[model samples]
Target chain A: MNFLEEVILKEGQALSDQVLKVDSFLNHQIDPQVMQKVGQEFARLYRSEGITKVLTIESSGIAPSVMAGLELGVPVVFARKRKSLTQNGDLLTAKVYSFTKEEENEISVSKKWLKAGEKVLVIDDFLAHGEAALGLANLVEEAGAEVAGFGIVIEKSFQSGREKLLKKGYRVESLARVASLSNGSITFTRNGQEAWSL
Target chain B: MNFLEEVILKEGQALSDQVLKVDSFLNHQIDPQVMQKVGQEFARLYRSEGITKVLTIESSGIAPSVMAGLELGVPVVFARKRKSLTQNGDLLTAKVYSFTKEEENEISVSKKWLKAGEKVLVIDDFLAHGEAALGLANLVEEAGAEVAGFGIVIEKSFQSGREKLLKKGYRVESLARVASLSNGSITFTRNGQEAWSL
Candidate 1:
């Protein structure tokens, strides 16, 4: 988490009060070394939970989820944004609004991949309004799978994402929680604290 | 390579003449152990290239590229198909035609991530028509970077992807090359040889 926070502090570019661009090492361009460290942290956090699979959305979430899956020795399943020709008809689909793209899109996974009573840990790069996370959780429930928890690289605590997931009684663990972004400066929550500190 | 060939022989699903779905381990649902093996194989193949970075496109390509990057102790850079509002303006962009989607879409990478004179190895899940590979290659070249070679998990040699990349003078290495898919049977090309035998 320290490595990730450090990387964010060093390389993360804040576009607005809400969005932070980590293309250098987090999403677009990835740092495998740092990613491994983050994966180890996730594995340490949820190893005892008996996670059967790691679930994520396309594009950004794939790298971190792959690393976590490798560390946890589990399968990684990603929900595709667009329905491909290869995708089977039996799928669990959910429509989610993307604040970044300013549009709504559907994410789906084959019913064959997820089954009943499986434990799935949802992972992603960023958590803002929590639409993507909720959508993934909805898919897991649709498959009759258990939501072990949600793991995120960064969370904007100033937003209502954390509150929304917590309201649903889903445990959300974010490596770095940004309490506030004022005047282009990011303030992170104190380490190992339930409530974010500004 | 034998391991990969065995995997294809055992788990590959042939839908038609043009489609072979291995989403169980290669793309949609990723097997961590097998993915690690793939990373090791790629490391073995390109270890001597002094690869500074592993380049790939988003969604499917991120997993293998991350694995390969981890094995080789290098960073991975994935080109994103959709540009977020936070994305930096200075980017290397290329137009890619997706046969599956039946449309042309643009992929881009922030110029800040790819430095001039960096040695990059492009990795992908499938190489059907070589548009994605060529698009990635174009982005790397535009950034004044050196492409070490291209690594593909599966290449449909029956298609023109390999021929196209070869004509561009790229040294392409595929773990499993399907020489043909006929009558619901898939044939793999022999390893490390230009001449493919079913």
Candidate 2:
């Protein structure tokens, strides 16, 4: 198992078959060491892609994405989540629905930050319904930039998020692929084999 | 001049006498290099404080605080901003009024993340009217923890934020202290002297 999977198994709470709470180390309370290592992992994976910038949503995605940007020696641009439309007209906006929050927020990136023909690497903490990932990709495309790939921390392979992104022809790399979270137990896929339960 | 001040002069916008826009490097579009340096400076300033954790507000504060936590070998916890009180009754909440947005947000920290007698270094991107800093300190105190000090990225010294924090006996260290933003130019405080102007 990777370091991330080991950490998840040790501290992650399998709240339900659909919800996995990693508040202790990932989202609410952040483990900087874990984030640093995760950043290094992302840099290792996408170093050859000629990524110009790292894009992520605000709040949860900032930590890992900034660390990855630091490792890759690129700037990090976070899309701000606004409940309403901002007054700025020079913004690349997308509508992202949060399955956990059950709300749709307008995520926006400033036009001045992103340039045309730039290769952007998108990063996020989780991949569930892929709404956020799709929204981020939409913003990059709107800026006339290329979405190089996505670096996700956790992927619920049981969900259709990963499949949807793959079908869209975007390279998605998730460090921890969760196979199951049932009966308060967590399981992972081995060597990209989803059928290998636990 | 410090590196942060240099970057501010180069890329930051002096929107008005009171408003400084650092979206290009510090907030919306983050320069990972500058953030890394800022984190190191924060760690250097507070390394002797015996801080067990780094606490900051979400979104803008995550990048610098997480980097400082990594340098100090501690966990970084971010308080989540909610439009209203959350359903969880175990959170330590504080009321913060934003001058720029003209909104009152109740920032909450989970009770499980903080422990009694632990020293927390409060981190924030901007120290203005001191509402956010005081609210962060209130959250730490509510958890029975001690607020070791405040690590701020930018401080508008003309505002009452730093004075209030100091009056409350909190050590406030800002990497870049802005004395004025008048006439589309930015000035800084030199050697703790606020009289130095551009």
Candidate 3:
């Protein structure tokens, strides 16, 4: 297994079948080495996409997105979940429903940061229901920019996030794909097929 | 002037006598190269402190903290500004009041991420009223850890943040220290003395 897949199996906690908490390395408590590798992997995959800017939602998505931006020598723009006091400019916004929070939040990007005709790569930590990626893509479209593709850290194959994005004609690259988290065990999808079932 | 100071002078907007908007690079939209340098600078500043972990608030603080963590070969823990569904465990929380937003937010770090007696370097994007830094320090103390020092990207030197932290015996290193933003001009502090009045 790849390092990411191995990390998931070893460090990731399966709270339930629907929830895989990777707070130890991916989100809450971050391992910078893993983030660097994730950045390199994303850069390698999307190197030829002519990406001009990297777009992501705030908080969890910032690290990986910034690493990829550094690798690509580009700027990274994060959509704010809440409007701050100093946020001044025309804003590009979209509504995103969070499966985890079970709520809808309006995510926004400053229009000044995203220019027309720019090729943007959308990045996020998880792909559970596709709402965030769709929202971020909507922001890029609102700015008259094109979404080159998406780089997701972890994709839940049991969910329809990937299928939905694929149906919308978006290229997606997920470093680790989980087929199932049944019986308190983590099983990853390999070669688009079911692999070692723990 | 350093790269960060140059960027602030060229790109930062002084909204009023009290607010300096650096959303163009530091906070909202981020420059990866600048962030990389900021990380390197922080790592260099705190190299001798024996920092076992890098702690910061979520969203804006994640990038620089992760970069420093990568340089230091340690884990970076970001306190959540808002709670999420999967955040389960004993939590170490502190209430932080935002002078800009004029609201109070309870930032929380998982008890599991922080261990007693670990040396933590507190990093943040800005130091204004010292509320956020104080809140983060409170978290470190609550977790039974020792705070090595603070690494601030930008500091409003006219304000009381540095003085307050210093009075509490906490070491602070601000990369760009703005002496004043009066008359829509950015003036910086050099060697603890006011300099470059524009």
Candidate 4:
């Protein structure tokens, strides 16, 4: 977590102190060794959860989620944001509202991948408004699988994602929790760190 | 490579005997253990290539590509299919026609991640038309990076991807090559395997 925080401080771009962009290390451009560590941290957190599958959204979530799956000795099932030509089957679909994209995307997972009674651990890179996590939980339920828990690399605590999931009775773990990103600065809740400007 | 070949024979779904669906383990629902083997295989193959980075596209390629990145101790930079909200920078773009989607998509990579003179190893899940690999190669060149080679998990040998890359003078390595997928039967180039039906 400290390493991740340090990397965020160094490489992550803060957009107007409101949006944290990690394209350099987390999402678009990836450091798989660091991602391996993130996955190991998640595995350590959910060691006794009996996780069978690691669920995530397509594109950005695949890296950290798959890393967690490898560490947990589980398979990773990512919900496709759009139906592709090669993807043909009965799918579990859920509507996810992205605050950043300002739209609703119906993400889907093939029914063949997530089976009934399987325990799923949802993983993603960032948790902002909890839409993706909730949507993935919906997909898990549609597959007749149970949501074991959720693992997130970064959490914007000023946003209501964590609180929403916790209110929904889901155990959510985020490695880096940001208290506020106001006025071109980032503040952490637990570490009680100074507000670092971009 | 034999392990991958065996897995393709065992779990890979034969769609119309022409389209091989590896959603069970490779792409949709990923078996990270198998992907680890895939990463190891790539590392073993490109041991002397001095690969500084692993390049892949979004969606399916992230898993094996990042696995290879972790194994090879390099960063994985995946090309984004669409420009997102946070992505605001100069990009190296390439046009890829998806034979599956029946459309052309312009994939872009940030100019920051891929720099001049870096050794890049391209990785992907499937190679059918070779558009993705070719487009990635173009992006690499645009970034002034050299494409060390390309690594594919599965190759539809009946298709033109392999021959095209070979013609382009790129060293391509496919873990499993299906020579024919006629009449719902899959014949491997190396193993001379059975023709499976969905």
TM-score of each: 0.92, 0.96, 0.94, 0.92
Ranking by lDDT: 2, 3, 1, 4
- Identify the runs in model 2 with alpha carbons over 4 angstroms from their true place: A191-198, B191-198
Candidate 1 docking band: medium
Comparison by DockQ, 2 against 4, better one? 2
RMSD of each: 3.5, 2.9, 3.6, 4.4
| lDDT, candidate 2, at A58 | 86
DockQ of each: 0.78, 0.88, 0.84, 0.82
lDDT of 4 by residue, A1-198 (tens): 377777877887678656988898788899998898888888988989999999998788998988899889999998889533244468888888878867778889889888999999999888988999999999898888999999998899888898889999999888888777777677666545532212
Clashes, model 1 = 0
Better structure of 2 and 3 per TM-score: 2
Clashing pairs in 1: none
Weakest lDDT window of 10 consecutive positions for candidate 1 chain A? A189-198
Q: Compared with the true structure, what per-residue lDDT tens digits does model 2 show for residues A157-177?
A: 789899999999999989899
How far in Å is the alpha carbon of B77 misplaced in model 4? Answer: 0.5
For all candidates listed, what's the TM-score of chain B alone?
Answer: 0.92, 0.95, 0.93, 0.91
Better of 1 and 3 by lDDT: 3
Candidate 1 chain B least-lDDT 10 residues? B189-198
Q: Where is model 3 chain B poorest over a 10-residue stretch in terms of lDDT? A: B189-198
